[model samples]
Target: MASKMASCIFCKIIKGDIPCFKLYESDKTLAFLDINPLSRGHALVIPKFHGEKLADIPDDNLSEILPVVKKLVAATGATEYNILQNNGRGAHQEVDHVHFHMIPKPNAEEGLGIRWPQQKTDMDKIKALYEEIKARM
Candidate 1:
Protein backbone atom coordinates (compact mmCIF):
# COMPACT_ATOMS: atom_id res chain seq x y z
CA MET A 1 0.00 0.00 0.00
CA ALA A 2 1.12 3.58 -0.68
CA SER A 3 1.87 5.72 2.36
CA LYS A 4 -0.30 8.68 3.31
CA MET A 5 0.88 11.75 5.14
CA ALA A 6 -0.64 11.57 8.62
CA SER A 7 -1.02 15.32 9.12
CA CYS A 8 -2.52 16.10 5.72
CA ILE A 9 -5.99 17.67 6.09
CA PHE A 10 -7.50 15.54 3.34
CA CYS A 11 -6.17 12.45 5.09
CA LYS A 12 -7.72 13.69 8.31
CA ILE A 13 -11.06 14.12 6.54
CA ILE A 14 -10.77 10.65 5.07
CA LYS A 15 -10.08 9.27 8.53
CA GLY A 16 -13.10 11.13 9.98
CA ASP A 17 -10.90 13.27 12.19
CA ILE A 18 -12.41 16.35 10.59
CA PRO A 19 -15.99 16.77 9.47
CA CYS A 20 -16.88 17.63 5.87
CA PHE A 21 -20.03 18.29 3.88
CA LYS A 22 -19.49 15.06 2.10
CA LEU A 23 -20.74 14.71 -1.46
CA TYR A 24 -19.42 11.33 -2.56
CA GLU A 25 -17.14 8.64 -1.16
CA SER A 26 -15.92 5.47 -2.73
CA ASP A 27 -13.45 2.84 -1.62
CA LYS A 28 -10.67 4.86 -3.26
CA THR A 29 -11.92 8.44 -3.50
CA LEU A 30 -13.90 11.21 -1.82
CA ALA A 31 -15.75 14.27 -3.12
CA PHE A 32 -16.68 17.10 -0.80
CA LEU A 33 -17.74 20.72 -1.07
CA ASP A 34 -14.97 23.27 -0.62
CA ILE A 35 -15.26 25.20 2.61
CA ASN A 36 -13.98 28.37 0.89
CA PRO A 37 -16.02 27.84 -2.21
CA LEU A 38 -15.58 29.88 -5.38
CA SER A 39 -19.23 29.18 -6.21
CA ARG A 40 -22.31 27.54 -4.78
CA GLY A 41 -21.22 24.09 -5.84
CA HIS A 42 -17.44 24.39 -5.79
CA ALA A 43 -16.09 21.04 -4.74
CA LEU A 44 -12.83 19.20 -4.28
CA VAL A 45 -12.26 15.73 -5.60
CA ILE A 46 -9.41 13.95 -3.82
CA PRO A 47 -8.07 10.48 -3.80
CA LYS A 48 -8.35 8.69 -0.49
CA PHE A 49 -4.73 7.86 -1.12
CA HIS A 50 -2.76 10.91 -0.07
CA GLY A 51 -0.27 12.56 -2.39
CA GLU A 52 1.10 16.07 -2.33
CA LYS A 53 1.40 16.43 -6.12
CA LEU A 54 -0.43 15.00 -9.12
CA ALA A 55 2.76 13.28 -10.29
CA ASP A 56 2.84 11.43 -6.98
CA ILE A 57 -0.53 9.75 -7.49
CA PRO A 58 -1.07 6.46 -9.31
CA ASP A 59 -2.91 6.68 -12.62
CA ASP A 60 -5.80 4.52 -11.41
CA ASN A 61 -6.43 6.81 -8.44
CA LEU A 62 -6.15 10.00 -10.49
CA SER A 63 -8.44 8.66 -13.23
CA GLU A 64 -11.44 8.27 -10.90
CA ILE A 65 -12.04 11.95 -10.09
CA LEU A 66 -13.33 13.48 -13.38
CA PRO A 67 -16.69 11.68 -13.27
CA VAL A 68 -17.36 13.07 -9.83
CA VAL A 69 -16.56 16.57 -11.14
CA LYS A 70 -19.10 16.08 -13.93
CA LYS A 71 -21.70 14.85 -11.46
CA LEU A 72 -21.24 18.00 -9.36
CA VAL A 73 -21.41 20.40 -12.36
CA ALA A 74 -24.74 18.91 -13.46
CA ALA A 75 -26.23 18.90 -9.97
CA THR A 76 -25.32 22.54 -9.44
CA GLY A 77 -26.79 23.84 -12.72
CA ALA A 78 -23.40 25.17 -13.72
CA THR A 79 -23.24 26.34 -17.34
CA GLU A 80 -19.49 25.97 -17.28
CA TYR A 81 -16.76 24.91 -14.88
CA ASN A 82 -13.03 24.94 -14.44
CA ILE A 83 -11.13 21.85 -13.42
CA LEU A 84 -7.92 23.03 -11.80
CA GLN A 85 -5.12 21.18 -10.10
CA ASN A 86 -1.97 22.90 -8.98
CA ASN A 87 1.37 21.61 -7.86
CA GLY A 88 4.02 23.29 -5.74
CA ARG A 89 4.20 26.68 -4.07
CA GLY A 90 4.82 28.61 -7.27
CA ALA A 91 1.37 27.60 -8.52
CA HIS A 92 -0.34 28.89 -5.34
CA GLN A 93 -1.19 25.48 -4.02
CA GLU A 94 -2.19 26.24 -0.46
CA VAL A 95 -2.77 22.62 0.43
CA ASP A 96 -0.01 20.09 0.19
CA HIS A 97 -2.38 17.22 -0.49
CA VAL A 98 -3.15 16.57 -4.14
CA HIS A 99 -6.71 17.66 -4.94
CA PHE A 100 -8.67 18.96 -7.91
CA HIS A 101 -10.87 22.04 -7.66
CA MET A 102 -14.19 21.72 -9.48
CA ILE A 103 -15.19 25.36 -9.60
CA PRO A 104 -18.58 25.90 -11.24
CA LYS A 105 -18.70 28.99 -13.40
CA PRO A 106 -22.38 29.92 -13.23
CA ASN A 107 -21.72 33.48 -14.43
CA ALA A 108 -18.97 35.13 -16.43
CA GLU A 109 -17.99 37.75 -13.91
CA GLU A 110 -18.07 36.06 -10.56
CA GLY A 111 -16.72 32.95 -8.87
CA LEU A 112 -13.01 32.89 -9.66
CA GLY A 113 -12.93 35.13 -12.66
CA ILE A 114 -9.62 34.96 -14.46
CA ARG A 115 -7.72 37.67 -16.27
CA TRP A 116 -4.65 36.40 -18.06
CA PRO A 117 -2.44 39.28 -19.01
CA GLN A 118 -0.62 37.69 -21.87
CA GLN A 119 3.02 38.63 -22.27
CA LYS A 120 4.95 38.16 -25.48
CA THR A 121 8.37 36.67 -24.94
CA ASP A 122 11.18 35.65 -27.27
CA MET A 123 10.55 32.34 -29.05
CA ASP A 124 14.09 31.14 -28.27
CA LYS A 125 13.41 31.35 -24.52
CA ILE A 126 10.15 29.43 -24.89
CA LYS A 127 11.82 26.80 -27.04
CA ALA A 128 14.58 26.37 -24.49
CA LEU A 129 12.03 25.77 -21.73
CA TYR A 130 10.21 23.22 -23.87
CA GLU A 131 13.45 21.39 -24.63
CA GLU A 132 14.41 21.35 -20.94
CA ILE A 133 11.02 19.87 -19.97
CA LYS A 134 11.15 17.33 -22.79
CA ALA A 135 14.57 16.15 -21.63
CA ARG A 136 13.18 15.38 -18.17
CA MET A 137 10.40 13.30 -19.70
Candidate 2:
Protein backbone atom coordinates (compact mmCIF):
# COMPACT_ATOMS: atom_id res chain seq x y z
CA MET A 1 0.00 0.00 0.00
CA ALA A 2 1.14 3.55 -0.70
CA SER A 3 2.01 5.71 2.26
CA LYS A 4 0.41 8.74 0.60
CA MET A 5 -3.29 9.43 0.44
CA ALA A 6 -4.71 8.70 -3.02
CA SER A 7 -7.20 11.52 -2.43
CA CYS A 8 -4.77 13.94 -0.82
CA ILE A 9 -4.79 17.53 -2.06
CA PHE A 10 -1.11 17.31 -2.96
CA CYS A 11 -1.62 14.01 -4.68
CA LYS A 12 -4.39 15.55 -6.72
CA ILE A 13 -2.11 18.41 -7.68
CA ILE A 14 0.65 15.97 -8.62
CA LYS A 15 -1.62 13.84 -10.74
CA GLY A 16 -3.07 16.94 -12.44
CA ASP A 17 -6.38 15.82 -11.03
CA ILE A 18 -6.62 19.33 -9.53
CA PRO A 19 -5.47 22.62 -10.91
CA CYS A 20 -2.66 24.66 -9.34
CA PHE A 21 -0.68 27.75 -10.12
CA LYS A 22 2.60 26.12 -10.93
CA LEU A 23 5.81 28.04 -10.36
CA TYR A 24 8.37 25.42 -11.32
CA GLU A 25 8.59 21.76 -12.21
CA SER A 26 11.31 19.32 -13.13
CA ASP A 27 11.57 15.58 -13.73
CA LYS A 28 11.49 14.81 -10.03
CA THR A 29 10.03 17.84 -8.29
CA LEU A 30 7.02 20.15 -8.46
CA ALA A 31 6.57 23.64 -7.14
CA PHE A 32 3.14 25.18 -6.97
CA LEU A 33 1.41 28.00 -5.19
CA ASP A 34 -0.25 27.02 -1.95
CA ILE A 35 -4.03 26.82 -2.32
CA ASN A 36 -4.44 28.29 1.14
CA PRO A 37 -1.43 30.55 1.15
CA LEU A 38 -0.19 32.15 4.33
CA SER A 39 1.19 35.02 2.27
CA ARG A 40 1.03 36.34 -1.26
CA GLY A 41 3.67 34.05 -2.74
CA HIS A 42 3.42 31.06 -0.46
CA ALA A 43 4.31 27.86 -2.28
CA LEU A 44 5.18 24.26 -1.68
CA VAL A 45 7.97 22.18 -3.25
CA ILE A 46 7.64 18.44 -3.06
CA PRO A 47 9.15 15.28 -4.43
CA LYS A 48 7.35 13.32 -7.14
CA PHE A 49 7.74 10.26 -4.97
CA HIS A 50 5.15 9.63 -2.29
CA GLY A 51 6.67 9.63 1.17
CA GLU A 52 5.05 10.53 4.44
CA LYS A 53 8.29 11.76 6.05
CA LEU A 54 11.38 13.48 4.66
CA ALA A 55 13.63 10.63 5.71
CA ASP A 56 11.33 8.16 4.01
CA ILE A 57 12.14 9.81 0.65
CA PRO A 58 15.15 8.52 -1.26
CA ASP A 59 18.16 10.86 -1.36
CA ASP A 60 17.79 11.66 -5.05
CA ASN A 61 14.18 12.69 -4.65
CA LEU A 62 15.10 14.81 -1.65
CA SER A 63 17.94 16.36 -3.64
CA GLU A 64 15.69 17.25 -6.58
CA ILE A 65 13.06 19.01 -4.44
CA LEU A 66 15.24 21.89 -3.13
CA PRO A 67 16.48 23.20 -6.48
CA VAL A 68 12.86 23.76 -7.44
CA VAL A 69 12.43 25.66 -4.18
CA LYS A 70 15.47 27.82 -4.97
CA LYS A 71 14.12 28.48 -8.45
CA LEU A 72 10.81 29.55 -6.92
CA VAL A 73 12.57 32.10 -4.68
CA ALA A 74 14.36 33.55 -7.70
CA ALA A 75 11.22 33.55 -9.85
CA THR A 76 9.14 35.26 -7.17
CA GLY A 77 11.88 37.88 -6.52
CA ALA A 78 11.34 37.16 -2.85
CA THR A 79 13.95 38.86 -0.69
CA GLU A 80 13.44 36.34 2.08
CA TYR A 81 11.54 33.12 2.57
CA ASN A 82 11.21 30.52 5.24
CA ILE A 83 11.63 26.84 4.36
CA LEU A 84 9.54 24.60 6.57
CA GLN A 85 9.04 20.84 6.70
CA ASN A 86 6.92 19.51 9.49
CA ASN A 87 6.97 15.83 10.45
CA GLY A 88 4.24 13.86 12.22
CA ARG A 89 1.03 15.11 13.85
CA GLY A 90 2.87 16.61 16.79
CA ALA A 91 4.64 18.96 14.39
CA HIS A 92 1.46 20.25 12.67
CA GLN A 93 1.73 18.12 9.55
CA GLU A 94 -1.68 18.42 7.93
CA VAL A 95 -0.56 16.53 4.85
CA ASP A 96 0.86 13.04 5.00
CA HIS A 97 3.41 13.39 2.21
CA VAL A 98 6.80 15.03 2.61
CA HIS A 99 6.77 18.58 1.28
CA PHE A 100 8.67 21.78 1.83
CA HIS A 101 6.78 25.01 2.41
CA MET A 102 8.57 27.94 0.85
CA ILE A 103 6.75 30.93 2.24
CA PRO A 104 7.79 34.35 1.02
CA LYS A 105 8.31 36.83 3.81
CA PRO A 106 8.49 40.26 2.24
CA ASN A 107 7.78 41.74 5.63
CA ALA A 108 7.91 40.52 9.20
CA GLU A 109 4.15 40.45 9.51
CA GLU A 110 3.46 38.60 6.29
CA GLY A 111 4.65 35.04 6.96
CA LEU A 112 4.51 32.04 9.24
CA GLY A 113 4.91 32.43 12.96
CA ILE A 114 4.01 30.23 15.88
CA ARG A 115 4.13 30.49 19.64
CA TRP A 116 6.51 27.91 21.10
CA PRO A 117 6.90 27.48 24.83
CA GLN A 118 10.56 27.28 25.75
CA GLN A 119 11.56 25.24 28.72
CA LYS A 120 14.85 24.93 30.57
CA THR A 121 16.72 21.78 29.63
CA ASP A 122 18.43 19.56 32.14
CA MET A 123 22.09 19.28 31.09
CA ASP A 124 22.50 15.86 32.70
CA LYS A 125 19.49 14.44 30.88
CA ILE A 126 20.62 16.05 27.60
CA LYS A 127 24.03 14.42 27.97
CA ALA A 128 22.43 11.06 28.68
CA LEU A 129 20.13 11.42 25.67
CA TYR A 130 23.08 12.32 23.41
CA GLU A 131 24.96 9.27 24.68
CA GLU A 132 22.00 7.05 23.94
CA ILE A 133 21.67 8.39 20.39
CA LYS A 134 25.40 8.00 19.79
CA ALA A 135 25.29 4.44 21.05
CA ARG A 136 22.41 3.59 18.71
CA MET A 137 24.25 5.19 15.79
Candidate with maximal lDDT = 1
Q: Clash totals for all models, in order?
A: 0, 0
Candidate 1 structure quality by residue, lDDT tens digits, 1-137? 23447767888899999999999999888999999998888999999877789988999987779998888888778888898998999987988888989998778765777769999999999999999999999
lDDT of each: 0.87, 0.85
For model 1, what is the error of residue 6's alpha carbon versus the real structure, in angstroms, after optimal superposition? 2.0
Best candidate according to TM-score: 2
lDDT of 1: 0.87
User: How far is each candidate from the true structure, as Cα RMSD in Å?
Assistant: 2.7, 2.0
Clashes by residue pair, model 2: none
| TM-score on alpha carbons, each prediction | 0.83, 0.86
Model 2 lDDT per residue over 1-137, tens place:
35346767777888899998987777788888898888888999988788888888899888877677888888888888889999999999998888999998978788888687998899998999999999999
Q: Where does the lowest 10-residue lDDT sum fall in candidate 2? A: 1-10
Stretches of candidate 1 off by over 4 Å are 1-4, 121-137
